[model samples]
Target: MGVRGLQGFVGSTCPHICTVVNFRELAEHHRSKYPGCTPTVVVDAMCCLRYWYTPESWVCGGQWREYFSALRDFVDSFASVGIKLVFFFDGMVEQGKRNEWVKRRLKNNREISRIFHYIRSHREQPGRNMFFIPSGLAIFTRFALKTLGQETLCSLKEADYEVASYGLQYNCLGILGEDTDYLIYDTCPYFSISELCLESLETIMLCREKLCESLGLCVADLPLLACLLGNDIIPEGMFESFRFKCLSSYTSVKENFDKKGNIILAVSDHISKVLHLHQGEKKLEEMLPLGPNRALFYKGVASYLLPGQSSPWFFQKPKGLIMLDKQVISMSSDPESKQGVPICTEPESKQEVPTCAHPEIKQQLPVETDSDFNLEVPMYAHPKIKEDKPMDMDSEIKQQVTLVSDPEILKVARMHHIQAESYLVYSIVSSGEIECSNTLEDELDQALPSQAFVYRPVRQRVYTLLLGSCRDDISASLAVKEWFVYPGNPLRHPDLVRPLPMIIPGGTPSLKSLWLNQEPAVQARRLDALLACFNLSSSRDELLAVESPLRALCCLLIYLFVQVDTLCLEDLHAFVAQALCLQGRSTAQLVDLQLEYISPRAVQLGSLLVRGLTTLALVNSACGFPWKTSEFMPWNVFDGKLFHLKYLQSEKGYSVEALLEQNRSWLTRFHNLKAVVCKACMKENRRIVGRGHWSSHHTGRWGRQGSSSHRTSSSCGHSGQGQPWRDQGPGSRTHEHDQWRRY
Candidate 1:
């Protein structure tokens, strides 16, 4: 957005002209040259503090205070050197940039969440980790500036524009920030904080004159180049097609436009020509795309160069100037008050004053009475005007009194003049003293009738034939054993009750005595059915011989499925052991083995099994299935699978394992290499080989040296000197080589 790659490109291209100098050195220079004069610098406070407020810096142990303290010391150092530092903090984002602001806010929230997670996981004393809440950091900065007796301007929109505009209005020394947009605004000087060094504290001033000269373009055409380079309001894609194809042509047009003094028109025409050539005349006819507010994107680009004009997006002039002194700081209360009031003094009178001794002249003044003037009406006037108007006024007042005396007349009068009466009624009602005919509570009671209470019994006794046929000597008992056998009298006949038929024959056997008493053939059939349910074809002896925990776990899972029972940890371990031919293995060891054998395929199977079981459980539960029957349902199978997958992927996934193996192989190969050659050289050669081998590489290197020597000899000969090329001083040759390197 900020002229993509402009800062780096400028620094690299003009490193000699754009030399780095410490801020302290500049302050010293200003103080020594202009003894009593103080150079004021407008600072983009918000932009400068972004690096300090990062999660790594501000989210740890009292860093907010420490950061501001450092900032305070920086401001104080400049103040000591007779440089007035004015800080400008950003305010609400302008309407045009609200979309960008929203995205930034979302990014900030993400950063905050990340910081919180890090502190909770990594810090032993997380409760001590603290920083300024939400907007408190900016407020703290403002407070710090105030304490330092520095004037701080809180911008109404963007601080960048305000900083630039204020610097120009005051003719300050320079504008300081990290923003690259300042390069386009060539008015006043600009410096980037990132270019400053902590050890040297150098400030690299952006030289607009050198930049324009180097680029072969004027200051006015820089914004157009920036537009093509891309900015916040203009998408990079808009000019991406022409960037490589027509950039040189555009630059040439700008450089050759000295014949036509209008640079803007020349650049615009050149752009249209290039577009038509590349995109066709039909595409060129279409209007350029605009910003969100329908402002031409080009206008926003050029607005940076024009000082007084504000861009529809991004830039806006600050409302007023911020000023400060030793005792107090103040800004212009009104933006319209551009001029200062003039002080006036009393002037001496030229005429002589009248004293008491000159009473004769004082008494010559004349006086007048009210009766000296006369008024009259013509005969063409109406009769009412001719007569006294007091009678008519009295008659109208009497009619108003009569209307006020009757409620119906008053109501009709109020309705006829609602606008006048409404204010009076609202005022009275708001005063909270209006009396009503009935209270709200009484009205509510009258509107709603009370309900009466009634009672009825919910239970009724029933007489049955079974109750009458019950034998004597057997007291009725609700115990399950009593229903199956006679009460603890061995001599008494046992009660014979018919058993409920099994819903599905050869289903999974219950882990109870009744199932254990079944014939061996029936038990084998049940075991086979359980194994078949899980798609396992192995016999009991084979399963026991393998003793694989995965198979045992699968068997336990199938048993829960066939019996419609919820899974429990203890029951799972016990059944899994039983499936392993009742092997004597600890639950922990079995669990470890089960986890080791879980593959991606096993995960998919477990996920599907869990999903189907959960669905069946929910359906049966909803259809009035007894809660006692399925209390051990395997509802946590999904959670177990998810945990396993996350652990494996995060800790030992196949991709990660492969990457680790490749790194290990590289390390081993590096260690086995001979010590004579440098690893960096080897790496370079490896990269070069990928591009393709070069033939006669030594010849290419020697040829470059030979050409340089030839040029040096020719220059020496032209100077009428017979000196050899090597005879030149080392420093001079080194400087020549440096220049060649730049080229």
Candidate 2:
């Protein structure tokens, strides 16, 4: 009667068992309830065991060990209160899969042998008595046969007796296991510690008494008592229906297995079906319990029934008894009032109303019998009245409701909008204007504030607007170096420009002056033309006719080139800072521009700038430079000679070789500058760079590592713009060009 029976079904092999002898205060009341029982006596063969090895069971870990120790000490204290020790075991088995039938049987035999050895040792203990019973499958088979007159192959053989003996001798039939299947054959009262312990022991005793009265059961014949409670009724049929629901037809795999094995497999599947249904709906089983009178009623019925092990099948049961129809008899099947009465607002004075069946009558036929005695019984009118209530159908009803208050959402929303706006701006720029400023207006109405802040300039061209906005914002906001090396507008929109400007800003000369005079206000005219070009809303043809895209682009390029022309400026200003640092006598008077550019550092910057501009010119041949091409100050061949003369005298104390060696570095800077020029030229040209050619151009300059590397940024890519000159050497002009050379 120990924990063996439960263990067999659940497939557990844990060594320890913990049983609650007295639910609340067994030590306090043991003597009063069972005075005849020996002092230190326990329910021998009754123990509760939980197996962690089963798939259904998880290990309780270290805490469970502590719990078991606590229970053991509690039981030892009970011995002090005059209750003999008792044990109840479900059962245990060695682990092996039944797929290999022979090995599984052999392992079961070995496990059974081990159990017998344990039982014999326990049986020798003084003042000990054991009562064990076969329940579950044994009781199920017996009841099934008694009810259905069917035979089952589920019998314990003589050799199997040795295998089952320990389970029957030392293990309690129902005490320790979670299963209710054993109640079918068990002879004693069964209680689950975790659940039933919550109730008072007196209440438990009362429930048990009522349960026995209902079924007419004695504790010794609990299995027979269970039969009265409908334990053997296979509602929803047996295993075959379960197999159909859970597995494919045997015929599908029949070709792969022998006929006998297939039959055996089906039987096994049926067993599995019954076992699962029994566990799955176990709450219904707990309603049955054991005591004295209910057992006698089951014993009186005394019919033996065995279950059939055959093709898996399910029994169909009466799911629900619905009332189909009712008939008003007038105490007769045929009513005399079949004719219809006229429809009227008021009850028509005494025209005999022809009666049809009541609405409830039409719905209650087939289930409720039409007989004289039970015609209008209200009790059986509808069995489903309680089930018709509405249920809460919302999926989120169980979820916690909360409002979002995080600022990260708004920050992200703003960033996203700025990025989108930047793209729109890119789509609007044109080559005709250089000084165009795009003012993005946040047009975000309440509808989609998260998507965008403003509408871009062009209404129809929205395709690239968002992307353009985002690209610009990302470059600006991140502060990545050289992010916008070339930050010119996409291209000057042709519509924004005009035919001409009377005068450029900064008192610079106009294009009219440049074209009209030989040397009249050279800087002023160049500046005037730049301003005019940016302001004019003229097409390329008109602009070229007036002062060419080439002229405008060249002027702009040269101005930037001069500003960043590292070596020329470097050479011109190197001596200024030195003279001041040494407080040397003024050998030569310097101009305002020359005096202000006082550092040798400017020399290196000038070299880089010159090289950069040269590269820009070479690369951007399409529309000329971004600035006016006419403004290019061709290198003076005379300056080269002047440079050589200065080096020979060592007037600057810098060597000629040092200056000459800078050619390579200058060429590299020149290449990158040329690339920018080319892009600007294309920007002016209106013809997009061919996709394949541009990609090749990009890869050749930037390589696969992209624009991140500083040492070898591409010649034409923009990320190279911020690089500063690292080496300063003697000044060297790239090629000796005549000053003021005409194209």
Candidate 3:
């Protein structure tokens, strides 16, 4: 549904812009021309590896590992050729697409089920060992990323937007991903492995500027065109049939407009024209109308254009200085240079410092640039200062210096001084004690309005917790948002209540207090209540069999506390495991029980147990379920109920009786038609006409004896002519007359 005909239209109208080049060629070009220049690129890693997670022949068995290894090697290849790669992973499905997310999740589960079924059926087959299951592949990807030490930034929403944003902000050389939506952003170049590579061993670079030119549209107009054409977030039925093609034709015929031109207004005008051309026909407007559709379209526009407004944390400008320690220097530099240089030490001075400059700042001397300095002494120290007291006569010895004749020593000495000076500057700037001539605000005043810096909105409070790793940081962030930000907000989850302890600072609430401090025995007595709440039967014995019934209860409480009914079994296990770890306990047995027993039971009791729970836990938690809120939700155009008899009658021009008659006529026409295939060519020849035409034209071709030598007025006038039925005089006349009558 992405820009309905975008890929094909672009290929036909603007092939040069989407040009592909080989990997080796691209790498060599950069190597020769932009040597030692690391061109930064944002990678949609998840999109790149999506197929690997799904069951595919090329990505079967250990092939996924090979694929990931190959991906790492590709990144390394770029790094070798001076390309800085920043990998971005999708964290959650966007709020606007939650309905689509749910449908996709359901589809994926069905696919997983199908794969499992196939594996079960082919268990004894030799080729059964060919593929790894989707779940196993997903786990392996995480492990591979960790082992490879690829630090990926997880976007809170659409990774494409984040990739586009980062690429724009940093002026990245390009964005590498499979999504064509990046074309809508029009800020950076885009690269795709599939699009770029003609062969397995080749890669290509595409030209974005040329592509826009070919389409006869400016880059800024793409998003509006995409909305009209339809995108993943917007349904194709939202627009009239063939409207996208008309828009493409319209744009292709016109000159490109400036960015200041009202592109959406132009689209609306075109749409109105199309609507008028098909005045009496049933179109998207006749079904859903324009007012609501326009609003949704604009919402999509705002979402993509102003993604930062949704996730403020990601857009926050990082404020800090990068420290260049010895380890950092060694890692960045070649091994040959690591051991050659000594750490620079400052020379002591006895002279009094000025009151304006702090003693700490004054004592920090710039690295000496001289090449003839002694190796063992500080760069500022003279030979006389080391040997004896620095008298007025000794100062003359320092003035008379000799240049180092060896080029290698001089080069090393120069590098050392450069590194030392860099460290000194960093120390002074980061210390924030030195007064600057102009502040950032002052600089902004002198700058053009477009170049001026905009301040980010400040957070009300900053929570600092020692999260061990990225996973913990994500979990903590989610927990804080659920417990603090969304608590008691009816707009989110109307049934959920905020815990009192979470509302108060420094107040820690135990599971018992949150659940009315009910004892284990008391909770057991009220097990019926828990079952009823989830719409489950009271007599479920598996719940009682666990070693710690309380742990199971705690798991349930945590799930409900998060205010999400549906949860991924893996995520629930992880959260429960973390909670147990905090209480100085192990969740090994509890996690096993939850996966095997409790989760299945919960699913049967009308709870959703999706394979991927991020959509619910993170996405829905951030921007509550669309159906629950008063905001307009797009109708499921594909729903069968929309075409039901009652619904059809509700529409102005549609009726069940008319639909039934149309279906019957279609069926009759389909059955009456006979498929004609040429025996010699083994391909479709032509559809046979009526009985008289077929008998006259095809009798000889089918080796049947039928007046082939007879000279008749309307049939077989070319007697014994040895010509095809189409070319024969009498047969052609009869075929045409029959076709005319049939029409």
Best by lDDT: 1
Q: Distance (Å) between predicted and true CA of 315, model 1?
A: 21
- Provide TM-scores for the models: 0.35, 0.18, 0.38
Q: Any runs in candidate 1 off by more than 4 Å, and if so which?
A: 11-17, 24-36, 51-57, 60-62, 110-117, 124-135, 198-200, 244-294, 305-743
Give all candidates' CA lDDT scores.
0.35, 0.24, 0.32
Candidate 1 C-alpha lDDT tens digits along 572-647: 2222222222122232332332233233222222332333333232222211221221222231112232233333
Runs in model 2 with CA error above 4 Å? 1-36, 39-68, 76-81, 90-188, 196-209, 216-743
Each candidate's number of clashing pairs is 10, 126, 5
- List the lowest-lDDT window of 10 residues for candidate 3: 450-459
Q: Higher-TM-score candidate among 1 and 2? A: 1
* Ranked candidates (TM-score, high to low): 3, 1, 2
Candidate 2, which ten residues in sequence have the lowest lDDT sum?
448-457
Give candidate 3's error at residue 194 in angstroms. Answer: 2.5
